[model samples]
Target chain A: MNLKIALLGGDGVGPEVLAQAVKCLQSVEVTFNHHFTFSPALVGATAIDQTGNPLPDETLEICKNSNAVLFGAIGDPKYDNDPIAKVRPEQGLLKLRKELGLFSNIRPVRVYPSLIDRSPLKKEIISGVDFTIYRELTGGIYFGEKKLNEKGTVASDLCEYSEKEISRMAHLAFKAAKNRRKKVTLIDKANVLETSRLWRKVVTRIGESYPEIELDFLFVDNAAMQMILNPAQFDVILTNNMFGDIISDEASVITGSIGLLASASVGTDFAMFEPIHGSYPQATGLDIANPIAAILSAAMLIEHHGLNEEAQAIYMAVENAIINNVVTSDLNPDSRFGTDYVGNYIANSIVDTD
Target chain B: MNLKIALLGGDGVGPEVLAQAVKCLQSVEVTFNHHFTFSPALVGATAIDQTGNPLPDETLEICKNSNAVLFGAIGDPKYDNDPIAKVRPEQGLLKLRKELGLFSNIRPVRVYPSLIDRSPLKKEIISGVDFTIYRELTGGIYFGEKKLNEKGTVASDLCEYSEKEISRMAHLAFKAAKNRRKKVTLIDKANVLETSRLWRKVVTRIGESYPEIELDFLFVDNAAMQMILNPAQFDVILTNNMFGDIISDEASVITGSIGLLASASVGTDFAMFEPIHGSYPQATGLDIANPIAAILSAAMLIEHHGLNEEAQAIYMAVENAIINNVVTSDLNPDSRFGTDYVGNYIANSIVDTD
Candidate 1:
């Protein structure tokens, strides 16, 4: 099979880690005898510097025409420090998601047994922890109407939700649960917010269609606690945009090695894959940043394309690298391997395997 | 000092643990030569069943007239399972907070060294973790205007913030910092919401008044990750109501002992202290629920009243109990101590001390 993938290396260590992902992808192509075409595009801080537009017309055009997008992290301290900055690198990713109608963000939180000692949590709590969160990407307060009064005394952000928006993500979460542990826990603040109540109503209604799946509800506050106390009890977590952002990031820590976590955002016809971590500008050229997240992102990208065997091969190689202690300083502070070395080692492992 | 306290033991294990807290308070009264006048009131599920109102008018009157309020947990499975229940126990606490103008929630996440092994996180990460989160209460999305469309297909909740609200909590957090590590970290999603921007502006301006303290900013998503990766890095966390509810709960797990955690919500003239955990209905009247949270709440109650010596005595007693392994079943699965036994032990420890 032949496919075209858009590569958006946003800023900082983005390009460095993304380069390793591409290297591993190339190895997968050779091992599987598949042809994958890659197109690079400008985004985030680098894009802002080049064209003064985070998501330029040409970049969107490339992504719209591609089969899948593999993104590097975005953000720069320059924009972060100036809270009033009119344009930021994050706008690029948000605009792209809105443009491509990427409504569902899938973050798979899995604990690697070998790295359990790195976790702050007890091993028993996180040993068998494996769950996926389906977060609504394009709706909720993030996209709601925001206002600042004339006197700047009062500011308000609207959190609006419609049945259509809730139903779309609910269907995706329930469907995914059918293939996994068949349990869907909807996280919302229904006790206080009408938007949350609407979420419960719509999700509960949609859940009826999936009789085989177990459905439950938890307030977002309690859900946050459960994520740390008993994460293994969850199979699938479905929540709004804001709650999803906070909960998924909180859950990311359960994996111990955040550098190994990967995420996928999907719509009906478009999907984008990326590491959950942000651009660490301080480590841009250090060659010490972990590339495992980006490599796993590539694996998710192919898995979305229905190449299960090829994706599993990439996953296996990355797992082998970790098991063999071939990683950047993030996992092992004294490890001798650099970013490129880990990527090259994983790629070699892929080709060396059956 | 003569103080009048209102005790609201709401439901389930509420009464069980509260009894122990009162016992310890009595011990403090004798040890410190302070007269604490106690008044009992019904609230939450028990109140709803007896008075047909979660926060009875009489209960509110008692809290309004008292020097401080000491609360046990609230919530019952019967009410939790029914998503559409109009009359609920939580409404009572919400109403009390609004009526008394309890606008700031202070949750101090402290890791007890003896129970560091109970944490899911590695001991090294949580050993010296001690931070307090100043969450703005009675404002933001929780108390904002909520509306459902005519067909109930769409719902909206407003997240509004004012300079007065943000400034009020900023001063408290900064003042608290002066007594601690002299650092404040404000968590908000300023890039996405206008309200968050307003928070940044107001907080930044307030930060100028305190040149001695270090001030930093983190988006809520990143703050969630930092809570686990480096909780000890934070001395004071200032955030909005919703963000506080979620992040504080997430921080609660870092302590590894939710039953031992305590919280205080304060306004200019009114304040309430309570355990961070909810009423476990299953453990109602079982005499096995941990009372340390409730006991520590009494400690906060005295601390709030400017009785530092008395509060310190209570804190010392509770610490001794934990270090000596005199805890309920929650902390030690095989422990034979019941709720009353632990409470009696703590009270006796207080009297036995200098």
Candidate 2:
């Protein structure tokens, strides 16, 4: 099978880590009977420097033409230090997400047994905790109508939602719940905000179509407490943009290393996958960023493109590597291995087993 | 000086915990020179059943006559399961807050030295983490215009705020900060909701008057994350209703025990003190629910009334109790003591020789 991937290696450590991912994918292709195409495009700060547009026409075109897009981290310290700047690297990524119709972000929070002790939580509290978080990416505050009043004394952003915007994601969440734990807990502040009430109304109405799945809710405040107190009770959790952004990160820390999580943003016919960690410029060229997240992202891409067995191969390889202590320095700081070595070990395990 | 205190022991464990708090205060008044007259009143589920109103006129009259109110937990499980019930227990507490103009809720999240290991977070992450949250109690979504549209498909709750609503609390928050770390982090989702913009608008303007204090703004999403990742960085956090409701609970877990926190709701002249923990109905008759929070709320009350030395005395006793393992089962399960014994122990410690 041929897989055509659009690789948007944006800026900072984006290019470095992405190269390692592509290299790992190529090795997997060579060992197994697979053909692939990787089309690299400029975006974020790099695009702005080359063409004065963060999400250039060329980059969007490549993303439009591919089966799946593999994104690297984006952002520059230069723009971060200058708070008054009109353009930012984060805008390009947000704009790309909006334009590509990537409405739902699927971030999987899983704990590796080897690193459980590293968690701040006791062994009993964090053990056996695994869940997928489906965050409504496009609709909330991120893309809401933001405006500053003329006097600069006030700035307003509108958090409005149409029923259709929530429908597509709720459907996916219900299906996921059906396969996993048969439970979907919708997180929202229905008792407080109008926007939250709209969310509860829409999701609760849509939930009726999938009666096989148990539906429950929690106010955002209570939900935040419960996430830390007991995370084992959740399975396929669904929430809006802002709540998802906060809870997913908080949930990420439940596992000892946040560097092990992978996420995918998918629309009707297109999908994009990436490791959930940020651009660590300090780790640039050092080749030690716990590449399993990136490798697992590749696994998601393959599964997303109708290669279930091949995707499992990638999943099992990484899991086996973790179980056997074949990890990068981030996961096992005492383990003297680079990102490439760990990636190669996982790739070899994938091909050698079958 | 004599002060009339209206004690509303609303439901289940409410009476149990409030009894412990009042006992401590009674001892304090005898040992010191302050005298508090306790007038009991019925509210919540009990009131709704007998008088057909949670906030009955008699209860309101008692409250009006009192100098300060000591509110135990409200809400009953009987009313909780029914979604359509209009005259509910929570309505009484909400009404009391609105009627009495108790606009600012002061919640303190402190990591106890003895139980910091109980945190889901790493030990280093939660150590020495002490911050007070100032939540605007009477405005934003709770009091916003809520409407169930003619179309059953859509429901909207309006979130609106004006200059005065935010300014008064902003100034109070700055005043509190001046007495502590001299830094206030304003938590708002200004990039999403119009009400937040209004909050930011007025608060920023009010913040200018307190130039000696440091000011920083955090989007509600970032504040939630920071509360977990690095809670110690915050000194005084000020936010609107909904954000505060969420972040405070998140901050509660970092302290590792919801039973350890207390809050005070204050208005222009009236104030209400209550433990931050909810009415644990299951533990009501078991004599196991922690009462340190309730007793601490009494401490805050005495301080609010300008009995600073007495307030410090209570703090020291509570600290000593926690340090000496003279705690309830929640904090020290094997410490060979129940709730009543621990409450008595703390009150005894208040009149210490040291």
Q: Clash totals for all models, in order? A: 7, 3
TM-score of each predicted structure versus truth: 0.92, 0.93
RMSD of 2: 2.7
| Candidate 2 per-residue lDDT over residues B219-241, each given as its tens digit | 88778767767898999999988
Residue A57 Cα positional deviation in candidate 1, in Å, after optimal superposition: 3.3
Candidate 2 CAPRI level = acceptable
TM-score of the second chain of model 1 compared to its true counterpart: 0.95
TM-score of each model's chain B: 0.95, 0.94
* Top candidate (lDDT): 1
| C-alpha lDDT of all candidate models, in order | 0.91, 0.82
lDDT of 1 by residue, A258-288 (tens): 8888899999989999998889999999999
Worst window of 10 by summed lDDT in candidate 1 chain A: A345-354
TM-score, prediction 1: 0.92
Q: What is the lDDT of residue A56 in candidate 1?
A: 96
Can you write out model 1's per-residue Cα lDDT over B142-200, one digit (the tens) per residue?
98999998999999999999999999999999998998899999999997999999999
